[model samples]
Target: METTFKDFYDTLIENLECYAGEYESFIDYGPKLFKVLCDLLNSDVDKSLRLVISAAIGYYVTPVDVIPEQTYGPYGYIDDIYLSSHVLKMVADVHGYGFIAKISSPDIEEIIIECEVKSLEILSDEEIESILAYIGL
Candidate 1:
């Protein structure tokens, strides 16, 4: 009952897409997710898991791949997928069976979906506009 990397990737992508219109929100959440990942990596009761998480995070956060976000449309999603895959792998490695169990639980999905929806709800139209302007969109 191990959690596959694909499960975690799907969850992260789903949450991220919910905030698509809010650049500031994405900027905020992305780094927080990275920090959570870094902490998880550093807290390796199993050293092997820790190493994988560390390496994956390093690869995920580094912005030196493919086209930049300025390229627009699908180009931006390339980096998103890369980062998502790394995070997913780390989650799967660390949590293993527990992660899979949680993924299968409707409550877990509901909580994530609800949280994502609430986060989006709190964002104001003006705030979104400001973020777009800041990003030169």
Candidate 2:
């Protein structure tokens, strides 16, 4: 069965402290994702696409969420992960993943890991589908 969002936070947080290797990758993911977003913004993409991308970025940094970051700590990033993957995939579909091509291997590893995780761990597929529909996707 697919991982429901219900288990996402616990699973994510559980994995965080279990591994022994350097987790600098997690710390680096934010900046790398932001840089990709910046590239998207600077590109000659369509206005609607740009707006959705902006909303995704805004959603990442915004404290407000289904579970507020203030209350959840690291697990709070769940929404950001999901939205970011969606935007990145869309951006890749249009502009190519070359936005991330020049990034360091470790950072690329983090990006690929995050994209894989978020792509699978959608919080509420129906809900996000509705939002995207409303946004004209």
TM-score of each: 0.38, 0.58
Cα-based lDDT for every prediction = 0.43, 0.56
Report the C-alpha displacement of residue 135, candidate 1, in angstroms: 28
lDDT of 1 at 68: 41
Each candidate: how many clashes? 0, 0
The number of the candidate with the highest TM-score is 2
Give the per-residue lDDT digits (tens) of candidate 2, residues 1-137. 88746433234345445434333334335445555665667767656678888886666556666545578665555555556666777766765566545442334545756754753454577756644553345
Residues 51-116 of candidate 1: C-alpha lDDT, one tens digit per residue: 555554554434443334445432343343334333444455556534533434433333333334
lDDT of 2 at 110: 50
Best by lDDT: 2
